[model samples]
Target chain A: MSHASGPPPEDRIREDHRRAVEGAPDGGRDTTPAVGRRGGPALWRRAVEGSPVALARQAFKDARWSYLYKDDTSYRVRNGADANERIQAAARRMRGSTEIPEGVDANGPFINAPVWTWEVPAYFFLGGVATGSSFVALAADLAGDERSAAIARKVTIAAIGPGAPLLVLDLGRPARFLNMMRIFKPRSAMNAGAWCLMAFSTAGGAAVAADVLGRRRVAKVLGAQTALLGTYLGSYTGVLLASTAVPIWARSRLFLPPIFVCTAVATGAATNRLVLAATGMPSGHPTRDALGTIETVAMGAELALSSFNEKRLGQLADVLEHGRAGRLFEFARWAVRAGLMLRFTRGRFAWEHHVASGLYLAGGLAFRFAWIEAGKASAGDDEAVARMARGKATVKDRLRDGRTTARVRTSARHPGRDARAARVYADAVRRLSLAIEGVLRRG
Target chain B: MTEIAIDRPESRRMGFFTDTTVCIGCKACEVACKQWNDLPADGAVFRKTSSYDHTGSLSASTWRHVRFVEQTEPVPLPDLPAYGGGNGGHGEVDLVAAAEAHGVPQMDRWLFMSDVCKHCTNAGCLDACPTGALIRTEFETVIVQPDVCNGCGYCVPSCPFGVINRDPYDGRAAKCTLCYDRLEDGLEPACAKSCPTDSILFGPYDELVETAKGRVLALHERGVTDAYLYGAGDEPGEQLAGELGAFFLLTAPPERFGLPAQAESPAQENGPVATAAGLAAAALGLAAAVGAFARAHRR
Candidate 1:
């Protein structure tokens, strides 16, 4: 609207100077336009103004000034408007426009969230159970419980049935599943896990076959070999998860494998115990007592290791405490607790042992799902990923920042007890994060 | 005697040295990379918060990404005068007058960086790929062999820089190859060739490192004291197995650009983790078996 008329003010001013330099009789004053540099005649000269159209326009614009400019935050432009002021106003608007909200990662969601779905966790559960069953079969044979050993061997084969297929089904290209066996890269946990799974399945299957054929010596030899590979099969998934950049899984490296192995044994023993009970094995049977003891110890260890790892994860543990994963973890904890309680206070009923076994199996499966889901959540957490990548520096920086903020808030609230209160608060924080402190100091 | 055969000289290790100080944020490198690689479009979703960086981060389809970080905090521009227009109205932006009136409007700096794969010497993806799909080229650039990749998705999580990704449509992992095909034909990478500011310099690894060091020194001489080389490091954690094939000269902290401060191959931690896992499994598995059998004997 300002540029809706003739030549710009600068051009007009230059033209006026050119005319004055030509030695015109009346200089450039008479030829000057009524609409000048400021865009209108002075208010005092309004009555003598030559252009009535320009004067009328000015009066109308002034009358509607408040209405037009009321909502505009840059209303100070009414005093003076220039390119610099306009640019500054734009910069101001841009600055206020879309600030990355507090706690939102400015640079990233970081690593690609794990692409695994239900199939992977399901496979983990089945694989763990199979490995655990193999161990049970070997142990039972050594204990001279041939009946229970045969049942354990059958269980191992049963679990391995769907485990291999579930793992293949989770691949992006399922048809290319055989590619995993094309290389023997022990450096890769996944490759090592694949080989272990194959070895365990082959040996376990042969053992089950031999047992059915009444070849006890051949079955025992194969069962021992299967159990040897089962150690990796049950625990290498932990290594697989830990060897990645996912914060929670990688941070819980030392605990995840042991936790996984414990769950495998617990679930395996539970399955074998339930089968034996269903076959009318008496409650006083030595095999039943052994299975019960093994299951109980394994469950206890799983719970203890999980708690320790969760404490070490710090704020990264939030993924395991909120959302779907959190609910699954909660259920798993309760299921294990219920199973342990039933084991401790079992009645004469065989159904009580069956129920306890069922709880342990369900709990182990739920634990696998919870860990997988927690890993996905942890991978998507930009702060946790950044903390992992930045390593101990970010942890220390955040801890220091947290302490300062706490001190400031406390000082503002209680000036007299600032030092003492701050010290107490800092000490509590230090204790809470002490699990990671050793690693940080070592690094 | 058998006829003596002529031998070819050993291939020189090549790399990219990205000097982000002079980058103009033109995004020519992004276009050139996609155009040359024949990669698919990364969908059309206008990201309102990520500034002009619409092609977000480096992914399977988009190999080179120009990161735009709009730092709006008020920073001191020491070289420029706060007040302006004293001498014949030449000064356009009267920052002092504007600041005095508007209480210092936030317009500090607009940092632009062209990010690509770090192509680490000890790449986590290469180490973790179970299918033997990811391999290091003669130029020392890590590339995923698309034909061989089974899309097991192991490499996706193993990359510490988050540069490699499994394409949802293709169902295979993909990332920058450092223009291996172009290198074979004695041509520079498309991204480096198309860079308007010569920000992305492609050359022999040793020569590029020297050039990068010289540029960093020049920047420091010109008062850009904060300028430092990332990935071209002597420190252990700063480099992944000695150095990255594609390193950067950055003014801001590495995290500000989504690069890790302590860059390392996640696979490097495999030894201790595997050892502990194996020990734990052995101890727990053996103990449970032994305890179960011993208890049966006692009974």
Candidate 2:
């Protein structure tokens, strides 16, 4: 009713701002004594009011004052009202303007959150590379690329140097590392990871021993076994993480194994490139080019799969995309891109190969390190965990009519059906995730 | 892995159903747990800050902890008119008159809940333990074989609840054994035995669950709408740590009592790991085949 002949919306906003500024000195000051500030207008005006706009801005900063203003102004703005009253009236027009009460995370919820440190991620990274190196060695040996095979074998065996100590170091005692294989239970991923690492290391060690002893048949046989164990070693760590209740790790359960395996191959091939390049394997050689191409594809797949999982994770993506872990994840992406560019450049410098492989290795390590840290961040946040838990629907369910229950409990009585449902639940989630990712990419 | 930690057919399952509503917050259970377990006093560092909490959390030393959470709201309990029984005429009359004159405003409510090890059904720490240091007892409770533990700290992160901690002096993972020694002798845990108000009740698992359900129903009838059982079926507790040996009757959100509202047990929680492994293998195989094809084409 008051705005019957007022200016346009934009101009009205401007006029309101001007009026607010003009009324600030006296109108805001005069109302202050009623609110209980000492020595009233003089002190408060000196501290708060240069203009009504300044006072309003200060009030916005103060949650309590904003609440009072919002509470007072929310209905009708009087055209000739006092500036403070007009400001309140203007604020009343805004939607969802609720006061934020003062509170605390009194329980120190995030403290003692995640105990995983350098040793665990380092073990995962080195062990994965070793596993992939063994696979590369096996592939080379089968392809009759003896020169590539021999170097691959040496790299595979040698990669265990840091890997062995890392596992032992995390265990805190050498005997404890041995004690991990007290009994093998296929159901437990940690147990399986432990035993897989042990066996792979043992076979890798034996193959290296045979190389020195000139036992050709023995070395080949053991190398094949190690490569087989490498399959589990390279990817089981992801399964191990997925098997845990950790929010970040568990949410990415479907994609983690594939991502880890891809990373393992990329890192392993990068290490192989460094070894071959250092040993004077010329650029554009068939074996070298093949390994580099394979590494590139694997890494690209890893990035795609990681993005897919992150998309499905919804709000939980903050941990992997926001904090210190987020920075490391960002660094890995750049490193991957830079490394890929260097690998393709025709006239790349001899040192360019070294630098590229170095970046690839750094990227691999960063992925593992950031993943562990992100798991910590994910666990600390209550909201993210809840959101992820709520995302029980797989991509299939999202698209289809028969949506699986929010949580599917498997009964022991119907093992076969329950197992099938569990498998379907998992597959539906991953397939749907990939589908959603495809849509997002196209969109 | 063993389904429920306390489902052993040979021995009856035992647990504690702590009713936080009636907890006195005296820290007696904390003292009793340490005393009976022969634990060292690490909570004595009187940090003058923080809430009125000394034994802030359950740790290797403090097996039980009473958390005092002070909330600034009008007190839940109404002002009583019968205090001092109106015995002293001048003082009592003056106090009553003063009470009528000034209304109680912003009365602080301290939510005191004693916490102990949850002894989760699908124990992540036990599943994650590589050295077999952690084991599910025949009594359906989980315990750490301290002699066998090599302090790998694997169990530390595995636990959804921050219950287990390493003894800094001994360098081994230690936590509430549910008084395994006493349980074997048919005795309740010291914390339950010592609770003055019977807030901490120990008995057969099923019976304790029934008692908790009844108490929650009673509280609801009495208009305590927020009162719900933690670790009770149909709650988020059942979703993760189903039928927890040590559960609670909380008057507010689990977070208010420093508890995770939705606890997840890794073993019970399944995802697409197996399918992902298969996909990974298939992708690698395809990549390898493409690499071979490219080499042959170049030839």
lDDT of 1 at B130: 83
Task: Report each candidate's C-alpha RMSD, comma-separated, in the order given.
Answer: 23.5, 22.3
Which residue segments of model 1 deviate by more than 4 Å? A1-106, A393-443, B1-9, B48-50, B78-106
Q: DockQ for each candidate?
A: 0.13, 0.07
CA lDDT, candidate 1, residue A428: 49
TM-score of predicted chain B versus true chain B for each candidate: 0.85, 0.82
| Candidate that would win on DockQ | 1
Model 2 misses residue A242 by how many Å?
2.6
Question: Candidate 1 chain A vs. true chain A: TM-score?
Answer: 0.65
Evaluate model 2 with DockQ and give the value: 0.07
